[model samples]
Target: MIITEPKPFEDILEMLADVDEVSIIGCGRCAAASLTGGEKQVLQMADKLRAHGKTIVAEIVSDPAICYLPRSKEVIERLPKNGAVLVLACGAGAQSILEVNPELLIFPGTNSRFLGMTAQVGEYHEKCTLCGDCLLHLTGGICPLTRCPKNVLNGPCGDCVDGKCGISSSPFIKEEIDCVWALIYDRLKKIGKTEILSQTLPSRNWAAKTYKPQSIELSEEEIKQRGR
Candidate 1:
């Protein structure tokens, strides 16, 4: 899931400061799962905006999650196109709204954190960075590229200070990150696959790290044939 966190209300208010009539859009998928931009949050936001003296023209928790282009487009088409729109979803969903309505004033209400998984009700773990490379099989099902702060591929950096990652700051590594290479080593040794680590991984293809647009196109005959 694309994990997200709610932006501060003050920031949201500032974004909508000049606008009178506001339309709110929420995601029913990842944002809802993360407890940031779900239906309940949308209503709460509406109430808060109204209290601050902003006219609410619409509040919608998109059933199709606001990122699914076609369905979200259909939903957005029916809303009153006025003033500004506050989207409580990930960056992708917010952009999707703009793609559907290019002229509408749209603002993000949440911050896209990472592509991760839910560990509990309020806990999320970063699983992947979408690095466009897969070496999990060699690393015993762990992705060192993302888990390791240094993105070490083949082996440990040999500079870990007591098995903790080297980065810690407000915008970077927040918590005491365990050395992912150490984890990989332990996992490989435990599984009797330590030999795999000896084989060094080639340099990552930096070109593959870009966002490549994709689409699915099927001919009428192909669709009809599949119906059988």
Candidate 2:
């Protein structure tokens, strides 16, 4: 599941500083799971806005599932004149709503955190960077880029103490091992091959390897040949 968090209250206030009649739109899906911008949170936000001298024209309404099956049209039709929508969904949902109604002004209420599974009741940890490459096989399934405090690719530095990252004072360690490379070394020892650490990692190709938007298409002839 994708984890998300509500934007800071100050940021939200600044974003909606110009709006008078604002509609707080919530998603009954992912946002609700993270306790962000759900019906309850939206109502509370509306009350806060009213206290700040802004006129909230209507109560917050949450669709069953706004990210995938948005009821944006219904919400827009019910909005008061000159009302702007404060969307409490992921970035994709906000963009989708804008595409459906280009004239409607939309503001985001939550910051999309990461594509991660809930580690505990309220804790979420990122497990992947989607770097278009997979190296877990050599690293004992631990991603240093996402799990390590410094995002160290070469392993834990000399500063690591008792498996805790020395960079951040926070003792809230994600993995039991000191670092990904250490974990990999232990795994290799168990497999009777402790010499893996001597092998150096290839330098990453920055241009050919990036986490940016990309697209691919197949020609008509190729599609026909593939019997698609």
Best by lDDT: 1
For candidate 1, give the lDDT of residue 195.
90
lDDT per residue (tens digit) for residues 42-100 in model 1: 99999999999999989998878788976778987755754588989999999888888
lDDT of 1 at 35: 93
- TM-score against truth, every candidate: 0.87, 0.70
Q: Write the per-residue lDDT of candidate 2 for residues 1-228, one digit (tens) a residue.
A: 556799998998998888877777777667777777578888888888888888876655556556554455565455554457887777866766665567668888889888777666677767887666677766666677677666666676786766555654546745454555566567778877666456666856666455355545689999899997
* Window of ten residues with lowest summed lDDT in model 2: 173-182
- Model 2 clash tally, residue pairs: 0
Count of clashing pairs, candidate 1? 0
Stretches off by above 4 angstroms in model 1 are 168-174, 210-228
Q: Judged by lDDT against the true structure, how good is candidate 2?
A: 0.70
Model 2 misses residue 35 by how many Å? 1.2
